[model samples]
Target: MEKYLPYAVLFLRIALALTILAFVADKMGYLTQAGTAPILWGDWDIYTKQLQAILPFIPGNISEKLAIVATLLEIILALMLLFGVKVRWAAIGTGIYALLVAIVAGYGVGINAILHYSLLVISAASFLLACCPIYKFTLHGIKKRSTYHPY
Candidate 1:
């Protein structure tokens, strides 16, 4: 179990990054998969509509802009994690982003089977990942061992 830990952590990191990317893509109007089914919403609509639909507390005028900001933040954290620059801190940021997402998702959609649980669980998992100190490809490790000052 210990030997495979790095691989497992890497997979989780990739999964979270991909998840963030997909959300960002949907918002950017690139990955449209709405299909012909009227039940499904359009990819372009995900940016503003989903937020409005999920979180009524947010004002309609600023929802889209706030979403864009959130998306960019998520992308930054994801990239940091993917590049192994600062896994621990990036993971914490990711977790915070996920919580923000979950706050909207959970309350907007209500506590349902997959919808609410998925967001909450992913946010929680990110927090858990942050607690782990076994980052394989990260600058955090090097920083820990360095006793030299670059000033």
Candidate 2:
């Protein structure tokens, strides 16, 4: 198990990044058409409506802007995780964002529904990655190894 720690962390990082990017893709209508079942939001308008539904505290006017900001942030965080840039901070950010979403969404959809969505699991995985000392499978790892001076 010890020998696989780095691999596990790498898997976690990639999984989180891909999961986030998938949702971003859905919101952007890169995945499915509107009125599609199972997929959350097909386009920005539907995405904004869903956001408003889940987080009703956000004013209708602000929900659209918030959805845009959330989508952009998710893209940035996903890329950061994928490239292993500041992994700890990125993981922490993802964890916090997921946790907040889970909490709010739980209120809207109930615990069982939120659990099915796996937001809490995502948050936990992100926090788990943040706790790692280093990620040995990242681009930074490769670069550092390539630049090593074995004097």
Candidate 3:
């Protein structure tokens, strides 16, 4: 188990990053018309609508703006994790973001939707990554240890 810790962290990192990117893609319309998917919003319009539905207290204008902000944050977080930049901090941020998402989304969609979307799992994985002491396969590690000369 100890020997596999790094691998597990690596797996979580990639999974979280890709999952975030997928949602971002869906919001951007890339995954529009995805076939019978469990939890995709399809495009910005649908995403905004879903956000409004989830938090009906918020005005529609504010909800649309919130959706945009959320998408931007997801993109930044995903890129940071994918590139291994500030991994631990990013993981913490990811954990917090995912947790908030779970709580808010769960409020509207219920336990089943939260479980189906794996938001809690994503949060847990991110927190696990933050607790890990070392990451052996980051871009920084590759750059520092590489013997290749570009000169």
Indicate the worst ten consecutive residues by lDDT in candidate 2. Answer: 142-151
How high is each candidate's TM-score? 0.75, 0.88, 0.87
Q: Best lDDT goes to which candidate?
A: 2
After TM-score superposition, the amount by which residue 75's alpha carbon in candidate 3 deviates from its true location, in angstroms, is 0.7
Candidate 3 lDDT score at position 65: 85
Which candidate number would show the highest TM-score if scored against the true structure? 2
Runs of candidate 3 exceeding 4 Å displacement: 1-3, 146-151
Better of 1 and 3 by lDDT: 3
lDDT of 2 by residue, 29-106 (tens): 998898888677789888788789988888998988888888899999999999888788899999999998889788
Q: How many residue pairs collide in each prediction?
A: 1, 0, 0
lDDT of 1 by residue, 63-139 (tens): 78886677779789888877776677788888887787667555667657236337677778789778775776456
Give the clash count for model 3.
0
lDDT order of candidates, top first: 2, 3, 1
Instruction: Report the lDDT tens digits of candidate 3 across residue range 1-151.
Output: 7778667777888989999999898877786574446547766777788899999999998988888888899999999889887788889999999999999988988888789888999999999888887676677667787321222
Worst 10 residues of 1 by lDDT: 142-151
Looking at model 3, residue 116 earns an lDDT score of 86
